[model samples]
Target: MKRRDILKLAALAGASAVVPGVLSEVRAGPIGHTGPYWITIQAGWGWDPTLFCDPKGAPVNATYDKAQIAKAGNIPYAPSNENDAFFGKYASRLCVVNGIELSTHQIEAAFRQMWTGALEPGYPSLAALLAAGLGGGAPMPLISAGGFEETAGLVPRTRLVGAQPLDWASLTAPSADMASLFSPMTETRIAQYRRERLKAKLATSLPPGIKSVIEAAEAAELSRPKLEQWKAHWPSPLSDDPSRALIQLTLAAFKAKLSVSANLWWMLDPAVTDAAQVENFNDWTARFDVLMDEIEAFGLDNSVILVASSGGGRTPMYLDEQMKGHWSVGSMLLLGPGIPGNRIIGGTDENLRGLPLDPSTLEPNPTGVRLRPAHIHRALRRLAGIEASAEAKAFPLDAEDLPLFS
Candidate 1:
């Protein structure tokens, strides 16, 4: 029979018949250490570190012992004692870090929450550590709320899963090409095309060895219909809001153990201040809380880490005019095994300066000023048993300014 005829016949087979054997071989393995999971929440917006973790409490100055203030900078302590009450409930599980230099923009309310624990900047770094601890593999490092972006940190071009850069726009309105590939109808059509194309091409160049391989692959893909299977496996339709999809995707990735790191970016652009946007943000946050509740239900606290945060600072135009230009500092929170409980670490100035002070040396400079986000990442890595240094080597900073898990 003609090779074209053989190719046509093979295409009639489905993908399951051919793909299963291959997929089983690629499944990820169990975690290397069974250590506690490390969850990192990456708050994209500039999070005011002062809110949840304060140093020397809002009114900071020369009157306050510079050394003492520096030492106490990352610890949550306010003079009026008003802010301290906010985080009283979670005090045991919380460790507030202050005086760490931040590299993003801030909003007022987010800053307020940081000092008071009313708002928590969930981060991605912590999540990556946890996923790694769970024995997942690369290409799934961080799953953002919308999608991954270039600015989302982590060394790009690596084998890390979920490391591919994502833009929020892609989440809401995925490219036509991707949509076509992921669509069931399109896959069916493409399968047909593959069959027809294979036949036409084989008629012209039919090398016996190549023909055999093509026939086998075509027969395998046809027999099982991998695209149909993938369509079936694709997550249930989620809300168009990228944030909601983000939470759902992260949960799915974790449940499937397909990725070791996933970053969920909750809405960051202040431009999304419309009613729809607010509702989307609230809904997404609620979904995130639900995810946490689910994790707790499974008693898998030690297996997963959830870190939350904004992208950059909010613009004055986005906030009340009275609070223009005054951005809030960012925040960080963690809940899982191997983490201290009910404790708040770090402090923020009344003006919202997160100053990190060395309690032992009693000094505060840019290097000593605040809890660097990288320190939190380092701490999480330590918890996960990853030896990577958290702080950027080129940057002058110390991890001691932050609290350690006891």
Candidate 2:
């Protein structure tokens, strides 16, 4: 028999000895429930909030109505008015917060399609959120589509709310060892591998520099005296394709009850090579819509929360010559369990200045001003069942924000 066949036998023998107990352990306990899942999308660049949710013609709106509109043409697009109609489908389980202000630099691009009511297809924010909230046990996993410099910081924020961060690449492409060893293939390979013990021994040496905790865990499993036991504990089979492997890994993580949150950030900054074009925003949004449908297919809607937001607004660099140095606020949409959906929460000035409106009332704050990102974060954490006292002492904004939580 081939060396592969020999190792397979040894692995199978080891697994048969442990499979029943391990399987029982998995099924015996109650799956830990970590409240709801929450997600926040940061439109890195300035996202024009006005295009999606505008204030009912206040001073800022008046100025834009008289000058900016004539210059920019029908400031609000067709989709802005349909917030209630579209989100209402998931009303009791969703909350749409508009007029969120993000402090960031603006590169040159005019007209904000990033958050202009049109969806970019295949964006993963909503899908990931839904998966986590509905998945039991550990906090929902957050997955990001595009890499970001601030991901480390953003991840901890979710953790504070009791959700875990699902590594995007790993989810898409699970480790080969995790699959080959634990899958049913192990049973088939058991008798074959035992006949070639020498080859199996030679192949088992781990490579250098593999020090991750997960790697260590795998190494420990591989060292088991009974190969069958180790095989039974290995992860399920994985695909050779990286992307397909990731999806499988994500599903496995969910099935294993290991993660509850995932996030995918689609680059919207014009400065980035991969930024979506204005004409393609609709197509992109549609892709995201389809992705959500796929998540629903997983039957995780009841426990998950879907959130969509822009890194920031963009100004089309190809547009009008005179328009320069202007920035727009980003937009956010929420849909999921326990959310109050089918409603727009805040308003924006025609110039995209976010107004300070009560989240419940949707009326302007008499105190005068706009809502800040910090407040938005506070509200979201609340939705996730993270008490204000549990928030990190380190404030994303001013140290004063700590007081708000206290």
Top lDDT: which candidate number?
A: 1
Query: Which residues of candidate 1, in runs, are more than 4 Å off?
Result: 1-35, 44-92, 103-144, 147-249, 269-285, 311-320, 326-329, 359-369, 388-403
Scored against the true structure, residue 243 in model 1 reaches a CA lDDT of 37
Highest TM-score: give the candidate number.
Answer: 2
Cα error, candidate 2, residue 55 (Å): 9.5
Alpha-carbon lDDT, every model: 0.40, 0.38
Taking the tens digit of each residue's C-alpha lDDT, what string does model 1 give over 4-41? 33223223211111122222112222323333333345
Error of 2 at 145 (Å): 2.8
Task: Tell me the alpha-carbon RMSD of every candidate.
Answer: 13.1, 12.2
For candidate 2, lDDT tens digit of each residue in 241-304? 3333333333333444444555444434543211233223433344345445544654555655
Residue runs of model 2 more than 4 Å from their true location after superposition: 1-35, 39-47, 50-94, 106-142, 149-252, 267-278, 314-328, 358-362, 388-391, 394-406
Q: Report the Cα lDDT for residue 241, model 1.
A: 37
All candidates: TM-score: 0.49, 0.52
lDDT, residue 340, model 2 = 57
Q: What TM-score would candidate 2 get against the native?
A: 0.52
Candidate 1 RMSD to the correct structure = 13.1
